[model samples]
Target: MDLYAPFVRHVVAPLHALYEGNPIYSILRELEQTQWLSPEELRRRQWEKLERMVRHAGDRCPFYRERFAAAGLDPARFTLEDFQRLPALTKADIRKETPRLQAEGMQDVRIRQGRTGGSTSVPLEFVVDERSAQRKGACALRHNAWAGWHPGDKVAMVWGATDVDSTFKLRMRNLILDRRFALDTLRLDEAMMHDFARRMRSEQPRVVYGHSHSTYILACFMKKHGYAAPTVKTVVSTSTVLADVERAEIENMFQCKVFDRYGCEEVSLISSECDRHEGMHINLDHLFVEFLQNGRPVGPGECGEIHLTDLTNVAMPFLRYKVEDAGTPTAHVCSCGRGMPMMEKVQGRVADFIVTPDGRVIFGVSILDNFTAKFMGLERVQIIQDVIDHLIVKIVRGEGFDEKVVRGFQDRIPEFFGKEMRYDLEFVDEIPREISGKYRFTISKIPNPFQEAAGRAIGRTPPA
Candidate 1:
């Protein structure tokens, strides 16, 4: 038996169990249990929560209070219909008003500062209080529940960040949470991957969760090399768009369901696909989601920008916050019996949309899918658009990278764009990580004023 197995079962398991019973956890658990409410009931409850949040912010948050006053809006009489009347708050708005947003009488309003890994180069710093933190943790647990993960189920995380310090509190928390593996995604070498495969086979984790791109890359290597790992019940991909090709390959290679999750740092676990394999279930109990087109709410099944209001985050409430992601709204009920609203798909983040010289826009994931089939053992790559007619391809060459693959991409790109664009292929040993430690596959240096304005409104700079 592994040396840490006993500690994991006894100490970590019990601690996680205790944490799962915390007040906030209980509240979230109750909501999840009631997720089968009728559509009308769900809407009623959502408005109630929204009203409470408006009142709370109007009283406690100096920023929202003043904004409401200047707009001649009364928080006490705020209605669901007035959602459009409220000004959208972007990441920039939050950053600019952080000082005023701080709770007045609370000396320790500093709580905790966290960074958002936005597609735009500009990251954000936000404060979270104890209640907010607990709510976030509970939301994560609820998502885990969809994959048959229990309170004490052993879990492994393949994450990008390398700043985890094993302090006493963290150590205790890990023990309680039954977390066995915390592999650093930055060091994804053959040896590291082999070691991870061995650990997974030995530990038999209930679920494996991580950045989709990195995990899919690892799975691809394992499948090509015929390395067998322990069977996980499910794999949850977060923080990036999971292309259909990647999803098919991952599911086949790992022998598990590939569940894609859409969320941001401001509100963790906003929507997740359930076991029924339906669309991503929006957490209506804790969030009020709006799909807007040109500043107006769109009807069901229409594509639009995603705006969200966090009902649980009282510390620094985010009201009608622009998340900068596009998706199609769905009013269709799920067979899974969950009354939570669903989103048909999260069309990739705003930065992933590339404008061509001919004014044609292409989705980043679509281009990657077209190229992946022609390339073998390509570890990572980045596509940079400097101008309408020029593109820089940064390739992190892997074991079998050859001229054939390069020529294939070179030929296919122009064929798709219908123009002979300048394509530069620069091969490197490894793609450099961003300041947040995650790699962005697409960036644009050319300034689109509209995109820049949108990015600024959301507190992120246009991706470049």
Candidate 2:
């Protein structure tokens, strides 16, 4: 067999990373040893990195320097406990003091500017050092291995595809290195799925990865159309929360395990599922993650907001930054025996909570659960609240969808979101992606008063 793709990856990819000041191989080597370390050893390393990172942020980052002084935190000699005593970083702080938070100097070095997909109408922009970039690359390769993909496996990305004029260099890069193709989730219509399946069947890809919802829809489409990705060994989902229904359907259709990963644009990969599939293992070497409710760490099995510290990114230290998602942490260790920590699951992003005109908020998941159970013909669903008094429900109707089901959905909306709002039921061919390529289940135009991202006041629940 011609192993040209694998051979080039094995030899040249590292060289490219090194030239760009990203030590991919070096990180890989370190991870190989660190993954086997004990949990105690892992945390020890995390504290060491945290100490260094916090000190660097305090000394160099203008925003942190002020906060550190106000909190009376001596970063130079702070212990792990001392670090926790410092105030948590919020999206508002990042927004109000972005320049101060950016690491100083090194205009000659690679400082990448990144933005979160503006699911909230306001996206946070941040910079990263080359060191953090390489560390993330290393973490990704290691995580992929857990999902049964080696360096050479042909990986397919089932994500947003660009327009008709994708550049030659980008196409060649995908052809040569990725051995991968994209399935424009931007429009997963009948024509798109047919064309995509044709290409995928030809490629016989080993791994197919995409936004969790997009991947689930693809699996359902393939099953309905009598197509099979027989060579596909594993399916990986990311960017969006994979609902229970989506997960079960994807695994059932693919006839393989689905490895779901959760992270964000700001800090890179947080956690990913291994073959064990019990829970996702946190990237301990790269991040210090905490799940908190009401500003304190929640007990095991309780859902809380995700607070993260990018241990490797000194250029912009995100110390205790709230990722604005809720998830449960586990005391139970993985059977796979990785030293990294584990989280039971990542709940949806804060934006996934839909708000009504009357200030009552509902999780898009609540809609999915009720609607999917009540209505039988949805391939995929997106709920958009673009105006205060109105909602546009986008549905990618499948086998059994009809006018009867449309009326059923309308009737059900009032049960969850009270009858104080207007809504439009738009049955579309497909659910498009955000500009940043991630898919969101719920999009709200109305703003949340107290905590915009959380979509609820400090003491309020969904409307009574």
Which has the greatest TM-score?
A: 1
lDDT of 2 by residue, 402-456 (tens): 8888878778777768788778888788777555445666777666532354432
Best-fitting candidate, scored by lDDT: 2
* Candidate 1: tens digits of C-alpha lDDT, residues 147-194: 665555566667765333367776665555545575677665678878
Model 2 segments beyond 4 Å from truth?
Answer: 12-22, 105-108, 161-165, 354-362, 379-397, 402-440, 443-451, 454-464
Off by over 4 Å in 1: 1-21, 105-112, 117-123, 162-165, 371-377, 396-407, 448-464
Each candidate's TM vs. the true structure?
0.87, 0.85
Candidate 2 lDDT (Cα, 0 to 1): 0.75
Clashes of each: 7, 0
Taken over the whole model, the C-alpha lDDT of each candidate is 0.71, 0.75
